[model samples]
Target: MSMTLTDDGQTFSAGRWPLSALSVASAVLIFAVMQGIVLSLTGGVFDYPLDDPYIHLALAEVIAQDQYGVNLGEAASPGSSALFPFLLVPFAGTEFHRYLPLIWSGVGLIFAAWLWGRLLVEAGYGRAEWRWLGLAAAVLGPIAVMMPMVAFVGMEHSLHAAATLALLLGLHRHFSDNGGVGLILAGAFFGAAFRIEGLAPGLIAACALFLTGSRRNGLATAAATLLPILMFMGFLVSQGLDPLPSSVQTKLSMTDPGDEPGFIQLRLAILLVNLREPGGMFVAVLALASFLMWRATPLKGTRWGVLVLVIGAAAAAHLLAGQIGWLNRYEHYILVMTAAGFLVLLPKATQGAVTPLAIGGVAALILGGALAYRLPMHFFELPPSARAIHTQQGQMARFVKDYLQTDVAVNDLGYVAWQNDNYVLDLWGLASAEAREIRTTAPVPGWTGDLTAKYDVPVALVYDHWFEDGIGADWVKVGEFQLTVPGGFLGGYVVSFYATSPDTVAMLTGALEAWIPTLLPHSRFVWAEGMEP
Candidate 1:
């Protein structure tokens, strides 16, 4: 039940194995249980809760074939994470590709849990009752930060969380113990590679080092952080694409373009909007509590203060420039880093006291759990969420691949593109720079028609309301796939099928008629008005 420092004085031994190894085992066990629940609900089909993973898989498939985009031979930067698709390249076109993201997620969970355990040990939690607390913290920390949900998302976020934790852990070690500079550099590099937003934490930590008089380490951290991102941008530029991914550009364009506010104003506006949400409020509280803990600590002038500063600055930056809730991802890295920073700092701040820090830690956990009140709900909803994606996007992919057997246009491009080799014209602009350019530059009524015609796409499956002004007057609404269950994480409950031209209507209608009988449970295909097979 107690942990003791190993001979190297770097990690703690909790029996025969290191505490980190035990933590990894605990995390894997919890993940397996969650997966079992989801599998049971979904009839043993291993599917991500969101359709987004498939987009990465689609890009990976093409990347494996010496291409870089979802559409074969077309060099496009659609994924937000430049490194994730390449990570999946080895598994691409293999039977194991679909499970690769989940596998990586499990690995990330294991790594994060291991890092959390090591961090607790490094923070002086290696004796008596504190040791038990450290063990509990290692097991519960990931859950508190919603790592299970991040894993279920099956995206780059889990690794992003782990890398961010590594960065913080490195910062702690370098400043407190005058070591771990290598960790700092590796964390900075891989963190940015996983998610571009990761640079925020790395830059903040680097600035902290510079201010703390570790000028050489500061510069190294900065260089390591920027190198991968710059390389990715250069690669995109070389591919004749924008320096940023299309997904990033599209998200930026969607955020109040009409106002055209100044940078400061825009960031402040975004921060305000974030603070209005429950999660945002929780982050604000966490930051405030972390600052107070730093102030209360005798070592405020030391590395502990640096950790608090970095965590606070990173959380603020995320609120200002990053997204918060897209299936409880996006902000997950910040949550994990912040929570881990708090745990590591608590023992030091409390000066090894039992009652006060325990009370404070419990309070913080309760507060976070309260705000994440939806965590349990989301856990149970995972199966239904997967079902939603499967019944909606999965069926869309099915209809396109099995029924139409030709190129198609779609607003949501993940499942359809991943399931088929046919050309998929992304109207929402995540995958196609041309589609993004068209949507952002020329927001007109008939632009979809022109774009589909340019790609020679015969049909489209789209959420009709999403394109209020661009569905095209000439495009026929041939049919729709309506999910009977709750939409959960879907963009819409009903996905409308459209024929790009009048000549394609009969073909689309017949395809829909044939596909109707094959519809999954809790989903129905309905013909559009005045249209029947």
Candidate 2:
């Protein structure tokens, strides 16, 4: 049960548990230190790196409460992940959730690292310092070895990354071991539970697994991957939810989606953005070198023609429908895809150096370890860069409940939607259907005013640039929240409060004038006076 990839001078023994333990310990230590910095700077670990995790947390709380959606009694799929929310049902309201993401992240990194370590050991790289390569790769290796960020995002991405690694290694080991199909199946099932896009990696593994064996193997692989997906979708539909979660559908441009900058264009744009980073530049050079030397060291597996085809499948699956660079989580999986490809293929290129191609694969790990090592090369990133969501949405949620006393509309649904019981009309459409319609149709300025009025939504917390035709001055801006940070996503962001009803406008305007001193100490209230509603 050995081959070109995992074959070598010495067959790996079964008593390598200590090294495995070290790998897990190292990954846990790195995560703890990194997160400790963020916690010290941010005040609390509950302030996740991204606001989206909160959306899932909110839904999980509802699910825990035996209800649905971010607002109880609403049967909407606000969370894009399948198993993640349900998994949180047990810890939804407890302080355990505050620490759960870090736990999940640590465990995921450790699991993935353990699997990769086994692959390396089987390949004869487990001797001396080489055994530590897998552990380091989990924390910092390649620009895509972004385990730290994934873990901090407080989402299911950590598990997704681990699953991807398991599938890649299982497929690689399948023909030789003849017993990896179970690993493949388990990886697919568990991965798909985390994200809808999880299907892509699992499907790719199935096809690769089939190619490595008989038709029956292929059929079994397909069944393992597809059956769970079908059952899950069926379950969602049975519950009166969409087959695909609302987040997935909206992101893929199905139900009033975001501005999709084409497929090829989006991929190219992501590549371009990467080219700007130092780690990105290094990765590009290494990939080019690997490509030039691929034929001399093709992976042990068969490709239709090119050695890069297996990697290409992953790229096609992701790029054709993947989201690119939204708060960093969107295209982050591409990192694992890229790193896994190199791990498998680079060993082939350096065949002369103790299978030098394999050594070359190990060398590639150095780039990420150097760049993203400590604090990461994303130097501009602050420990608590998420202050906006925690403060703005949090304060605004309370403001709505205490002052407005009615349903409101919003674009950023995470903070405001979760912190209060108020019904939120999500302009981004990830949460509310009516909001999605408005976003899809893209009302003409004044049209949104009419729409809001129609829905009896008197107040909206939004950015002015969102409405193209403008909601007309009559809607009236009562307050403006300033968001400023160096190179931050919300830099210069101003959340404006507008009211439709004249009476409500007056009340909100007066409320803002009175509260601006206390709530918005440094902020100002912008009044659109003399404008009639």
Candidate 3:
């Protein structure tokens, strides 16, 4: 089957099955290769590079039992996406739950690839070599978007990217064929549910619709996109917590109520950081060039111009408010959106004067350079990255679960909280509102200690340097977990273990002594001072 584009280049026949299959197969192959690398490094243990996914799983378990936070019956908004954990509720507490995110991500990849293929077809790339190039881009989407990386991260990012594509495709359909308003709303609601950042593209597309005089559709789109987020925030508020999820509030460093900078200044500061990133700069330049080319060409009329406005506005919004890179996960949807917009606009901008070969060559260079910049390096780094987490966080989980068997304090919360039934005090603020408030508003000497003492936390596994103001005078450095693994993604190579009081020092040291022999290869526990058991 082949896609057929109409004369107006606004619509295409339904024939994306082959492209969808190709994309799924290609993604599976890529994922299999990544898993092979991970298996080789960790002796066949499948684990995510970052421990954040486990946090979601932990929350899912709690939610399944009619709770919210990681600890049982504790109400806290730790998961960023208010919807992701609930989605995992059915699978929570099962061995299969761990793979659920990967499966959902796979489904998202297939749909995204299919939608992108349809968009490319509408853009007049449905035939011959152009079709093949479109298929390639459809399968991989965009190199800079790092779809594979996000899919493997076991998070909602892949689904978020897919929803963004759906919105973009819906916008194209609306402008060109005066249809697909349903698709836009579906994209908006699900997109926002997947990630709050997803609202930027949806809202931008809705505004474009409004400006293009589709007022009813625009209003529906705006409401549909924002409803889920508003509902989530309402849910958080009902729990006597902050309106936003703890994870979101913690990450938006600028919006802290205690922050000195005004909101606009902080936004500008975030924009500055975005521009400083090489990937961010490249995307910005591409968006600017695309906007210029669209204005210069005959395609700047109402229909096509809407696409330009939506894409440009979405990119600008992301650069101003969203994050750029955290293992190439955040801002992926914007990268994909920008790349798709550029591809659709390129031929129109050049009026077909540029040969397909030239265009493909330029795309090849850009994709190659982007892949070189992060993909290959991060791909190989995945295994070691997982290993590092296993060596450090995973080991910590084991010691806490098998030995401590009680509530403890830790700056990094994922693995430990997920593995144990004990209460986990997250000093990092992601799972603890109290901790977040103290860190942001009242960070001072012994602040960490005060929080831990309040929670009755006896031991803490944290990075000491992270607390320059001191963890607290009551907190005694008992030992440290040192990862000997080289070239992996981690906050630090060493995680310090501190007993909240001197009396607990002996207990911690004894636990460390008993657990040291079982430590993962290449990681060891170093005793502090004369505390060696």
Which candidate wins on lDDT? Answer: 1
How does residue 253 of candidate 1 score in lDDT?
84
Which scores better on TM-score, 1 or 3?
1
lDDT of candidate 3? 0.77
If scored against the real structure, what TM-score would every candidate get? 0.94, 0.81, 0.93
User: Once superposed on the true structure, which residue ranges of model 3 sit more than 4 Å away at CA?
Assistant: 7-17, 139-141, 254-259, 350-372
Query: Looking at candidate 2, what is the lDDT of residue 95?
Result: 56
- Report the lDDT tens digits of candidate 3 across residue range 158-222: 88888888888787777667477888999898899999988888888888788778899889999
Ranking by TM-score: 1, 3, 2
* Lowest-sum lDDT 10-residue window in model 2: 1-10
What's the number of clashes in each of the models?
0, 8, 0
Candidates sorted by lDDT, descending order?
Answer: 1, 3, 2
Range of the 10 consecutive residues with the lowest summed lDDT in candidate 3: 10-19
Residue pairs with backbone overlap in model 2 = 144-335, 347-357, 347-358, 350-356, 350-357, 351-356, 351-357, 353-356
